[model samples]
Target: MGPLLLVVVVFLGFSVPPYLTFDPSLSRLPPPPGNHVYYPLLVAHVLFGTVAMVTACFQIWPAFRNNHRRGHRLTGRIYVFAGVLPAGLLGLYIGWHTAAGPSVRVANLVGSALWLVVTAIGLRAARQRRYGDHRRWMTRSFALTMSIVLSRVVNTVAMIVLMPQVDTTFLGSAELMRYSAASIGPWLSPLLLLLLADWLLERRKPGAARPA
Candidate 1:
């Protein structure tokens, strides 16, 4: 978890500054041609997603959760309402309208939809006072929430492997190669994280108390 939090911090530190000025020119990925709303939406997504990432660290911290139950619940609410809710909603629109190519578009759509759904289920479990269910679902939610970081790692690695094949496999189109590599990470990262989350959950004794 410490490493995860550090990654989040480092990601935000590097990624958020350019957007702080609200300059479309500074966008990491240029918005699709003539999609005037894209930059604004990107800003919103990044801001709220930042909130989600930060709050999630606390939400999953065993020491924090154990020592401050009320803080845990409060942070959980903030994470859901202020973080994933807005970020996920914006992500759906961004995904649908992205210019990153069909593969990345599909990945964005699926990942955003799944993120929203998993988060909703987690919120529902908490509302019903099902701590165990809530913990399981939120664990999955956290995995999805943090998928962006892992996706970056995956994207970097994929780019490294795919770059050399661009002339043959990508037909000399760097754009295609870029988007294709970008696509794999979004789809693959969440799946890996969710599997890890479930595996961790399964290792626990049945009916065990929710993790602090």
Candidate 2:
């Protein structure tokens, strides 16, 4: 997990009250397919994803695991079964009503799917005693999870810092920015982070904790 991303997700997860409440206006979510189910589902997604991130962050720390093996297993169980599984599935459901449109929907759907698959692989590897593989795949899983934070980073850059003043084309100004975030940015995020993880791992010696 990225330090900045861990901090951002942890803080945002706690700070956003309207997200966890019945009121969806302060939630800033797009209108769901039906009025009845969207808000509750969104709240569940937020809560589960936040808890998952917290557990995942703790899992990455060698000191925590070294000291508390049972706690590590407990957190891993929460991260996978309770936190990521339902949250990822709910994210796919919520993708239909995303403000960023189809590209974002596709991105999120694919990302969540991969997050589940990768994390499952990690969990399986651990079960089989492949600790290094578990470490690697979990890193990939959390990298995808961190896409939420990077979405804002990309949106800030593409929409505010890099937006052209005199550009009017097929896509509107809003479309350009939001699409850049939802579609384009996240596709590149996990790949880049995974590569960085690999490089950092190489720098550590022949055998280490696999860079988490």
Candidate 3:
């Protein structure tokens, strides 16, 4: 049920962008002050984001369902091929191109770096045939991958909360706060989940029995 909700949020977040006609150009670094590689970098970021979000929706399926058959294998391969690979590459590209400001750039770099690490760990765990480890790592990856949804949610909430505190007309300030929350908050969700999973796994291990 939770995974299904995550899928819905991710689908809506990614699907809305191309049609909105808003200036995604807001993300690009302006000329002279911006990196020469910015355009290619931004393009790569969007490409990977698209792929990652789509693929991430599938990563949770194996966890939710008991069927690990040929169909699962085929879909998993496609997910890795189309989603994880592009996401990792594009995440690295965007991380390197992160801006110099004391705001969104830091969050972007951190999110991208975390995504790369978690995704790589997921791949490695799968390679080692560690299904439990793989699931945990993939959970982390999906958590990071869903930053797009969280970011928007955070922004919307912020706008509503801050409406009474200041002039909500300042979309730029509101956006900055939203971006920060979205990028940073999502990281925490996975980290906490990883820690909890580890703790639970340890507790369930043999010889770790409680006195009760």
Candidate 4:
């Protein structure tokens, strides 16, 4: 688990810089058809998402949460307010503007919505001193935040596995099939990941002790 987290952290750490600079060489497309606004928003999303992602790592570490409660709380504030909030909002806009297809766009909306709602719930829980709920909500939130990475991985694998199975002759365009595969991955991966996470958590949690 630690190793996996480290890898994700590193991936996100590296991913944010290209967007920060807005280099066309690293861009997915050419500014989305004349919309100057899109570029800045994409950059903002990456920046905020990066902050949230980095801070979320420390926030979730049991050692930091348990031993350095003060630091945890401080980091939580930044994660929620500075990291997830604006990033999630901007992400929705980007998702809407994304060119692939409705599936990709819808996936973005759902992912961004989950990220925002869960984080908001976590922040509220913390304010009320319901630390347990806060932790749970934040866990869910962080999962969606990391879904960006998961989406890419899933997209790549799906493109590899499913693209070949797609009969482009009947389907009209192979490009559309490719887009579908990519979109399917991003849309499906988050729900699958969230369910798996919940299942593992439930299994790991101790059942109520029998009355002695």
Against the true structure, whose TM-score is highest?
1
Query: Considering only N, C-alpha and C atoms within 3 Å, which residue pairs clash in candidate 4?
Result: none
TM-score of each: 0.94, 0.83, 0.64, 0.89
lDDT of 1 by residue, 106-193 (tens): 8888888888898899899989998899999999999999899889999999999999998999999998889889898988999999
Stronger candidate by lDDT (1 vs 4): 1
Model 4, 1-212: lDDT tens digits are 58857877788776766776777568664467878898888888888888888898889788988999999989988998899999999988998998888888888888888889888998999899997787777888878877777778888887787666667532656787777777877777788778876765666566934447
lDDT value, candidate 3, whole model: 0.60
In lDDT terms, how accurate is model 1? 0.91
Better of 3 and 4 by lDDT: 4
Please report, in order, the local distance difference test score of every candidate based on alpha carbons: 0.91, 0.75, 0.60, 0.80
Runs of candidate 2 exceeding 4 Å displacement = 1-6, 13-15, 165-177, 205-212
Candidate with maximal lDDT: 1
Model 2 lDDT, residue 6, Cα? 60
Model 1 CA lDDT for position 138: 94
Distance (Å) between predicted and true CA of 169, model 4? 7.6
Answer with 1 or 4, whichever has the higher TM-score: 1
- Record all residue pairs in model 1 with backbone atoms less than 3 Å apart, i.e. clashing: none
